[model samples]
Target: MKKVLKVIGITVLSFIALIIILLSFLLIKNYLDSKKPIIEDTYYKNFQSDATLEKKYAGLGSYEVSLVKLKSEDDTIKEYKIWYPTELKSKSQAYPLIVVTNASNTAASVYESFFERLASWGFIVVGNEDKQAGTGLTTSKTLDYVLELNSDSDSIFYGKVSQDNIGVIGYSQGGAGAIRAVTEYDNSNKYKTIFTGSAAYSLLAKNMGWEYDISKVAIPYFMSAGTGSSDDSGEDSKTSFGGVAPLSSLIVNYDGIRNDVFKVRARINGAEHGDMLTRADGYMTAWMLYQLQNDEEARLVFIGKSAEILSNSNWQDIEKNN
Candidate 1:
């Protein structure tokens, strides 16, 4: 009887120890995740071009911003938002459309600043209103809805939006889905390009049974990541850009580089998982303007003195290959 009690005590002690170890492991993991590098304004304080940020529109000028919300019980974009340039009064030009959603899966309201920035630059930016970032289907649906609107001749936006100049942008998992969307939905390649920030879906996508090829995408691919230690997006961008000579050509998105057909990879300093989602600053703005509008001044930022400005500010690495 004494031996039996001793065995029971030993088993109880062993179970208690296991529980302690599990709790400790969880605590450590939580602590480490909280330490991932994040963008802080102080990080850019010493930058030489910090002075320019104070000027209007990050020195790119501005436009009147407008918002449209779509919310219905039967709509895919239930409670979504669309930010666009309102200065198209009595105009007849089809503007490029840029769609942005968060991998964070929050409402479009959470990313107002980023969308506003894109819209101010004269691109129609749409975001899903729901927290459905898991599949990225809704993001595509948002684009389809806008395209449908553009076809309505009686609608205010009829013939005012370009069908071929669409760009899909997102961060983390949302970014991966955006990349996949280029091949999955737009099979004919309606989208002129793709821009993803830190989407390492090589593992997650497969686990979820979403098999996609990064190489099949033939459009201009622009990817950015932080040199920080965390593999937040599964290193999908880094791996894709570094996988092969033909697969990944490194070139900085600059003037005259586009005519040559190149891929761009930008490494940013102190950019955490959420920086681009909230504030990609002049970098994304310049890239979009260059890609969609063929804005020369915007091109200068990526390839000219303004490039120096960002170099002075926070960009650690910006290179591309054709």
Candidate 2:
């Protein structure tokens, strides 16, 4: 009986110790994640080129950026964050708008610098606190809220958002959200272009209840992933043949879109899934610039024989039906 009691006590203490260790690790990780810069120059360093579109768009735009946060009653999408050009407050011009979907376990607050950078380029960027935004419901609702604000006479976004020129972008699970945001909702036709970074592939997305049908995607599309082990872990014979969004999966998605719809798909050579959020910012930004703003300089990066991305060393497996 004494021996049994001792064994029980030992097991309980071991469980407590394990829990403590896990808690400590989580605390440390949160602290480190918080310490990371809102924007890092290292990720964009490789894209810098004096004569290329990368040099200009990868860096900050001329407009100063500002952020606004609004509370929401929805439980899943608790709030919305809007990053815009500060000049919009005084300037009479309308700016393009981009709706950003958050990756799994992340929110707009966690990637403020990314939105700020895009806003600096003269785009109004919006995102929400939906950590599990794969469903697209929150993304659609957030867009509705923003459009409503655009019509409110007293709102800052009033008469400032260009209704016809809008885009949607996502990374990881949010990549799935971006797809559904344009394909699954009533406001689906509002987006002019879509971009995804390491979006969750079909198998994984279905398992997570975030399945998206790219066949319904009719607008300009740009999708990219990374070439790291985390993104290419599974074997062909396995049930889970790819990680988040492997080349094979991206190819499948690219093929699903109608041939007439403009689409481009590629992967960054050394970047991992997480690295894609900012690593591909140069081309990603240029895609929006070309598709939504009709910027001639940005167009050179995607079209013509001298298209920069095709020859860029950082990218591979380029496929596009222009």
Q: Which candidate comes out best when scored by lDDT? A: 2
Off by over 4 Å in 2: 1-51
Candidate with best TM-score: 2
Task: Give TM-scores for every candidate, taking all chains together and pairing residue i with residue i.
Answer: 0.69, 0.88
Q: Where does candidate 2 have its weakest 10-residue lDDT segment?
A: 41-50
**Which pairs clash inside model 2?**
none
TM-score, predicted candidate 2 vs. hidden true structure: 0.88
* Per-residue accuracy of model 1 over 102-216 as CA lDDT, tens digit each: 5654556654656765687788888875554545667767777778888987766788888868887867667656766776775326678777776644545545544446656
Per-residue lDDT tens digits of candidate 2, residues 212-251? 8889999999999999977777565137557788888988
TM-score of 1: 0.69
lDDT of 1: 0.62
- Segments in model 1 whose C-alpha atoms lie over 4 Å from true places: 1-60, 72-76, 186-188, 208-211, 232-260, 303-313
All models: lDDT? 0.62, 0.87
